[model samples]
Target chain A: MKPAHRKIEAPRVTVDIVIFTIEEAKLKTLLIKRKFDPFKNIWALPGGFVRSKEDIYAAALRELSEESGISGVYLEQLYTFGSPKRDPRGRVITIAYFALASRQKLRIRSASDAKDAGLFSVDDLPRLAFDHKEILEKALERLGNKIQYTNVLWSLLPEYFTLGDIQRVYEIIWGKKADKRNFRKKLLSLGLLKPIGKLRKGLRRRPARLYQFKTKKYVELKRFF
Target chain B: MKPAHRKIEAPRVTVDIVIFTIEEAKLKTLLIKRKFDPFKNIWALPGGFVRSKEDIYAAALRELSEESGISGVYLEQLYTFGSPKRDPRGRVITIAYFALASRQKLRIRSASDAKDAGLFSVDDLPRLAFDHKEILEKALERLGNKIQYTNVLWSLLPEYFTLGDIQRVYEIIWGKKADKRNFRKKLLSLGLLKPIGKLRKGLRRRPARLYQFKTKKYVELKRFF
Candidate 1:
């Protein structure tokens, strides 16, 4: 086959992250307002162009930290969006990633090209720039699907959490209440949750038992899911 | 965050396809020998750079047809590989896709920048160029995982096939012998298979009952898996 002699300009590659956390029993995502032209001052997912020497994952982490002051969270490459028209500034493609973090442990501070940063309930997100609305929808679908079969919910909770806390995280992300008895039975059968030998403290009613996630057990059980 | 001051060259985005099929009870993939430098004359997954106006998925389909003359298969974006050194030709990011087709229907012909094209058993593949091996490995794992819960196996078989045909395809891809009774029981329980009230033609033994995949049933049952 003959090689085509036409030269094509490469599209700019950027990393956009959808950071999910649970706040006040609601599913929330971190968003930042852009500070420059081309969607300037509009809330968008936290991300930027990847440097030539940096790996894509590193670029994602850097942008995540620069915008929201978040680091060392459970991050995974969600998808790649390249519709030629998705970005207004010429041709641009984005490698979208989704991360899970504990809301109580995070301190949000807008920095760099972000005028402001905050966690907004996913259901009540503000108008976003670019194709961010589509990206956010896809991330939510993935998060909801993943919580059913994977142990990703552990990332959104404290080290010691009650079964009720875990169930609430599932209910909010999935947008449906799961049967408490069935949910508990399935989780215990998986053997990925270990009892902490203590009950949740400072509660007016009976304290629920606390449990911790076992990463080793999760790895083994993930295949079955 | 301040806009990154360093002017960076945009990475060339391309699409790569790992096409798979079942041949003689062995799982196989279509490979093409490259005709250009930076891995010239070496077997690799069929792909090319996305055009300025084309979507990534369209680019994958275009390259698959250009190199192997195959089209209208079950295609999905498998993953994105963008390590800085993944490609020797400067900075290039590849959006890897995998397609499934029946061996009996496809007619392979090397075209575009490919010198030759052939199907090779995945168990005994030739030395691949660039990071094609890594791409192929990930695709195999995904295909294996998907077949267990999804109706992707239908893409590797003809319109009318027996239960034994389906079981063989599963065993080859999963790399294990599935108990025949248990396999049929599980598939029937899922309600994703419909008998066509016909028998295998001209077989050396008693004719086996023919069946087809029920896409609607599979879609409904997918959420349960």
Candidate 2:
């Protein structure tokens, strides 16, 4: 309510993304080496400063493309980090997003400045710059919680997958092994997937039956772990 | 990536909140009349510009206390709306929060500048200022989705409640009548609530059994609608 309140400085905004994918039975995240000062050559999440009059979503996708050389995937906003001393340059706040994709879909053509892109396992990550580590940790918690109540795991799966295929995804993301008998019973009881009447050969040489999610898009499941 | 990007005019930040409570068997929200220009004399969600070097959560609570004259309640961060044209005075982005309180617990003591505080039903609200209507709509959607899988509805109830008491709350929220037998069966099956083994002397002189949530805090249910 004071007149001096109008003179307060505004904080700069940036957009960062945490792209996660399941590859080789491991959960991996995309990282990029910074090409500018204040963290030059240091690894960080793919992001950049928001442009004048640019929509936040546009800023997020634009940064992802410019820094990671990927485009045209949905990026869901995760959280905004606005700690006063988070950035060495100035008072900077970042709107973070998370994207889930299948390893078979990405065709990373590192756009010149993004020549040093890295995919590190969540269990073992290198030091990240500018409070990006905190942002990534929050995204990981969201991922664990999201898989609990929703069928969003569909984003990281092929068109049709076997029981072992889906169970392996859970095991990888959960960072543990699941009891096969109990896992199969619980998965079937949820009734979210349907048998396609087809089989995939060569999982221990036993033709594993393929199943597909009944819903076309991501949805909340009535039952969860 | 451009040289001029460094001076892209940072957008100002603000915090807004949606406070919902069950009053007179209806879902009501707290709003305030602006004391200054721009939206002066117009009703809007109780909020204000975030002060420089201030935490977003602190700003949210400060605005709620200064404008709505209530404090100390936990506010959950819902979403950050950063559309470029969301505000008329330059570029302003708002981080919104939502809180659910029981009507019996609230004691509204309107402060000087917030004399025109209003509590209107979410179903019948006035012409909201700025993008508040959109923000309010999003909060309502979150409220509906939240009650589906979490024990958050306990915030709107007293220490002890009967099956009918909880059922009425659901009917009010869903805006429909639920079958008595089926509702009772499904609610019991969730196993979230436990009978206290004490009957209250009321309801047509028929002693109605009371119940309490097993968990002391809000929790995500394994089974949901």
Q: Name the lDDT of candidate 1.
A: 0.84
DockQ of 2: 0.31
In model 2, pairs of residues that clash are none
The deviation in Å at residue A99 for candidate 2 is: 0.6
Off by over 4 Å in 1: A1-6, A216-225, B1-6, B189-191, B214-220, B223-225
DockQ of each: 0.45, 0.31
Please, what are the lDDT tens digits per residue for candidate 2 over residues A50-93? 77688888888887766555555546899988777788776777
What is the CAPRI rating of model 1's predicted complex? acceptable
Q: Pick out the ten consecutive residues of candidate 1 chain A with the lowest summed lDDT.
A: A216-225
Give lDDT tens digits, candidate 2, residues B1-225: 123336577788888899888898899988888776667788788777777688777788787767556654546788888888887776787888888777765666555655488788998999888999999999999888888878788877777889998888888888989899998998899887899999999567789999988864768775455
Weakest 10 consecutive residues of candidate 1 chain B by summed lDDT: B216-225
Task: Report iRMS values in order.
Answer: 6.8, 6.1
Cα TM-score per model? 0.91, 0.81
